[model samples]
Target: MTFEYAPAPESARVDIAPSYGLFIDGEFREASDGTAFPTVSPASEEVLADVARAGAEDVDAAVRAARAAFGPWSALPGTERAKYLFRIARLVQERSRELAVLETMDNGKPIRESRDTDLPQVAAHFFYYAGWADKLRHAGFGPDPRPVGVAGQVIPWNFPLLMLAWKVAPALAAGNTVVLKPAETTPLSALFFADICRQAQLPPGVVNIVTGDGRTGAELVAHPGIDKVAFTGSTEVGREIARTVAGTGKRLTLELGGKAANIVFDDAPLDQAVEGIVNGIFFNQGHVCCAGSRLLVQESVQEELLDALKRRMSTLRVGDPLDKNTDVGAINSAEQLARIRALAEAGEAEGAERWAPECELPSSGYWFAPTLFTGVTQAHRIAREEIFGPVLSVLTFRTPEEAVAKANNSPYGLSAGIWTEKGSRILWAASRLRAGVVWANTFNRFDPASPFGGYKESGYGREGGRHGLEAYLAGPDDRPGERHGEEEDGRAS
Candidate 1:
């Protein structure tokens, strides 16, 4: 007998206002030009709320507010800053249920993921950074490191609240005020975060949130008043921001795209390797930037692994974001679905064997079944490009050296995973892999204390752990007469 799960939906406990405005200087206010756009639920195509669109004028206002708050905020003792972060972290935990449901509604990810993965991480990030506030001197940057004034942060929609936490928590803990802009497709949770700030009674202008499309991000990055810019998004947009901030004396950090590889060795445990492959690619409907989109398996185990993988894929449930039993939900938007479809078609045209499980999809919402292309070579478009959806490309390698070579062949060096029982081989392969983060016998694992970022085109600078604090701080050399390698006589030794 086949087991079936009862329909379990989370309660809609969070109240979303019909419309939302910019959160600047500790208040919700309208855009100066009165421009607004509607945000819709990707699962049902229902309009969730109309959010104000920030233009140049509003970006300028947010920057000015952050600049104004910088002196008083940065002057506050480190212990006081730690108190504010602690409050924010506690409040996030208290409101996890409401935020999780809202995230499922707006972002079209499964309720289970929102509750289990996203919300917990969001709260933990704040809690971890809160501890670092009073311990900066011991962090090894400098004895008297200073805040870099205001930070302009722009985050993507894949993990809206989590990304916001990653950006805002460290910036605030380092004594820097922030002007953040959530992605155009999803802004509800960030607005709700503004309410959390109010409940914590965080001082005005310490954390400002602006909502809009790419133009708003461009404006925020280009604003002369912003002392630092941190962004997480596509490589195309990252390049644009890099050019915009060039020669402007602004500190910049980017967490961009990736096409990570998940390699399975013949000596590995077959069952666990299959599970890792599934989790690495299908989690969050494959919207993750560090997703293991490319699968490189040893030729000896290729047939056995493929059979097991297909059998596992057949059992995955795809539908309703609110359903607790669902494994995959709707795509984030219609445009993204189109891109996935086009790339899948290209894969077929390039003579690769394409396969998708026989899963039913809702008629009204944007949906794509979990897909995989086999017999893919390095020259295939599907293998080279980032599909950014629930799609996987399969290739084969003969040895550990070949696996490492194929994995590092891509322009992106964000993340990669190795599956084997040999301890020495794991260490050797990890040393050779060009990615910033590598996992052995596991995939997609993250921690608040572990620094996460990428090498090469996947973008620069770390986002978590001790390294994250440096992005928001000014080193001793930034001050007059405190230059490194300088003698007391004010000349280089």
Candidate 2:
């Protein structure tokens, strides 16, 4: 006998304005050119809202607002800043359900994730940074650490609200004003967050949000008034931003791309390892930057692990993002869907054995079934490129040394996972791994107090905890400006 889950869609209603203007200072205004673009629901390809597209003139205005607001905002007592952050945290929690529904509609992520994971973490980040706001002197940065001033921040669509929380909470706590540009595809949640700022009675210009595509972000980053730039997105864009800001006296931090690995040893518990592997790659439809897309299993247990992983993958439900039972939701955009499809095709072209569950997808929205490729090699495109979709690549290793070698073979060093019961083996593998954050036994965990970022091509500057404060705080020898954040690596809880 088999049991089926009934459609359990969230019934909450969120009021999204048909047209939204840029949130500058304390009010919303039309773009300089008065142009707007439609933001669509990836789940159904439905046009949700017409959002104002920020141009060069609009970006300059936002930077100017942030620049003007920085003086009073930075001069506020740490305790006062703490009050505002705490208020924002409370406001987030108060309207979390509404935000969760909005997130599901706009971002095409499961309601379960938006409600259970992203919203909670968003509030927690603000609360965590609030605690640090009044205690910055004790954070080990310096006795009088100064704000970086007028931060120009760009965030991705994967975890829209959460990424905003990660960037905005810290910058505000460190006493910096911000001009934030949410990704083109998922700007509704960020725009709603602008409303949350108003509800919290946050000061005008302290958290300006400009909604638009990559051109808007580039304009904001290049603006002369922006003292610092913080961005989370593709590595290709990150490299370009690095070059754009080099020697320009602007402090810059980038949290970019990754293609992480999840290693399973011979003695690992089969069921537990399978679960970890599933969570590592399939969470958020594998939109996470630190997703463990590569699986390196010990040769002795490769066949057994493959069997278990396939069984688990067969059970994942792919459907509406708002459905409570949906495990994997739509890909964020049609462009991203094309990329995933291309990479999966490349895996086949490269002689990798591809497998997926017998899952029927919704007819409308952009979707890709959860997939895994076996017989994969480090030289394959699927193994090296960041697919950014719910696709896993499996490879085998004969020894621990080989597993580490294969795991570290990628240019990305954001995150990696090790599964084994032995404490010593976990330690040995973790110590030798070149990734920034290594998970043992479990995967895809996060917390507000822990620092997250990557090494090498994965980009740099830590976000969260005390180390995160360093990015926004001026150095001892520095005058008043600097830049920071994670590559969205697996985290604390």
Candidate 3:
């Protein structure tokens, strides 16, 4: 017997302006050319706001503003900076409900995830970095590290605010100023964050946000004044950014695409592994960069596991983003929806059997049902490429050696998961996996103190914990008066 769930929609009336301007130097202003684009809700295709489309000149202006503020911001005592960060963290918690509602509307994620997962993490990142602001000497880089000057950050639409916090918090804590670009499709949260900066009394130009598409991001990265670059997006775009910044003396960090594998061994807890598989690929409608889209199961228990997995997925509710009961929401955009459709078609064309539970979809929104592809081989396009949707490709492996080999066979290696009852087996598989982040039995778990990133084509460098601070910091030698070349008396030069 099944029971129906009552619709519990959160109030959609958040205070969003009908129009938004570029946030530069702690003030909102129109783009230099006054060009603007409308950002629509992916769920209803309704134009939420006409956001300014920042041009090259706007990007230049933002960089100049960041450059201007860098000296003052970087000169502030770490303790002072910590106070500002702490204020921002408190403000974020205070406004989390509004921000979460705004995020769900703008980015097409379920309200629960935006409220429970993303919002908490966003605040935690700020609080975590705040604790380290005055304690950098203990972080082991050096006794007195210096800021890296202006940072040019470009974050993708998925996890918009969380990504912003990831890039911005550490940069500020390390005494660096930043000019950030949020993805075109979801720029409201960042703009709202600009208000947060204002509310926290963060000094002008300390954190600047320019919202636009790829062209604007390119300009920010290639700007002559930028001292560091941080981007989280597709691998293709990452490579292009790498080429743009090469030989330019800019420190670059990228957290790009992934096709992570979730391996379930025969000895694994079947029920727990099934839940992990669901959350691994279905969370955020599988828009996550480190999502485990490929399921590598032991051949011995493949049928039983598949049955359990299908039964679990059948219960997932896919509907309105504002609904508290919705398990999956709309796709981020029509373009992303089309791409997911094309890839699913390709999977079928390549002879993989596809299955999706019977669920009615809303007629107005951009949506795709949670789907699974079985009888998938390693050579299939579904298994090789990053689908970036709520689509799972299942493949069976006969042995642990084969599972490890198959898991590492991708061009991407951001994260991987191993579900086994034996601790030795978990360690053995984790040691062999090429992923940057590995989970023994759980998936999609994150902490501000744990460094998260990937290897290979998945991109380089880490983005959390004490290690993340190094990206925006200069070593002792890089700081002239603090600790440079040794003096004859064996003191700081």
Candidate 4:
């Protein structure tokens, strides 16, 4: 059977180029090594654009640009710099539809998520940090806080624009200049973000976007000029980055992998719990670092919750990413699909019973049926590793303590969800859970006012709120009287 996709709002609305190059020093330039890579649409496996493959030399140029802009950009009164961030945020809003469409086309996420969740959050992140400019002096690092000289940031492909905003906004807000590398699989959104910076007329070197694969990211991270490196990706890569930068005096923060446990008690609200579980593990086809892939149900309610979960999973719509009605979309790339498949296979081999929602996945694009594995013991591979797909592993716990024990068993402490009617149980589980972000009676929720990060292998440092600004900060000498962990509360923007 052949299926046709409706045109994306911006796919037909904008003028897209045949090729995109690295954005450095306020211009588009080819990779220094003259290498190029093809970016394909995960929704259809069609070649979308040829992006420059940056090498070490290109990384140098981008870092140099960022370092050059640091003085003037850092010297600018915080309010003025804030204005540029605001301008970029406004541009993002103005072109939200185009950005959203292009995002879905290349990134393989639902258009609705690209439109509502990713795009809005991207804009809001900038806007949130925009207000933080100039306010940092009043921010609790003391009377004054100095900007870190140059930041090197590498973001994942899962949530392209949002991750860009996560890197850019906080860096700009805290007064640091940045050289950022977007994931090779989804470089289009970063190029568009660079265009918005150009439109905002932000200073020539304040932000530079270099496009490439792992090698490029490694170059950006290990560059001597970068005073700090902030990264969002897999735990393995994050560890390698940490090792490379060890003892270099370069500050670092990593938001890495996760195998979060979403626990539901017997007395919890079933309907809301079901929705949270669906959004937790299935949203974005469960590609999120903080995704809740492990489900821990109180033993008494195991059968009831499993029934509702399967029933709800069956209703999910998986197909073209451009469709506004899509509930689950294409897997990000072929390699990722293979990894998810391997993990799913491991689950079966480990004696877990796996089931998929009855839906037809696309033939051309990378696809995985929304999957769930029941009868999953703690020892099962599905419950232990990060599958990073719309696959969940269900386990049962005899008590709240057992739930907390099981939840904290994983080395990755990114995030977790708790569904319980008992206030004491909610507080207990939240406090005991090793994850950084605890969703009490909720799941997969993000806000500019909240802090998001992980505890152990999931990585460190918080993004969002005042804590998020710390990544861009330098020594205490910049602020003569600042104390660590003391927030400058009650100050207006």
Name the best candidate (by lDDT): 3
User: How far is each candidate from the true structure, as Cα RMSD in Å?
Assistant: 4.4, 5.2, 3.9, 5.3
lDDT of 2 by residue, 338-369 (tens): 99999999999999999999988989999999
Q: What is the lDDT ranking, best to worst?
A: 3, 1, 2, 4
lDDT score at residue 243, model 1, on the 0-100 scale: 94
TM-score of 4: 0.94
Taking the tens digit of each residue's C-alpha lDDT, what string does model 3 give over 420-492? 9999999999999999999988999999999999999999999999999988989867742222232332122
Instruction: Note the Cα lDDT for every prediction shown.
Output: 0.91, 0.90, 0.93, 0.87
Any runs in candidate 2 off by more than 4 Å, and if so which? 481-493
The collision pairs in model 1 are none
Residue 288 of model 2, lDDT score: 98
Instruction: Point out where model 4 deviates above 4 Å.
Output: 1-12, 476-493
TM-score of each prediction = 0.96, 0.97, 0.97, 0.94
Error of 2 at 389 (Å): 0.2
Residue pairs clashing in model 2 are 445-491, 446-491, 446-492, 446-493
Choose 2 or 4, whichever is better by TM-score.
Answer: 2
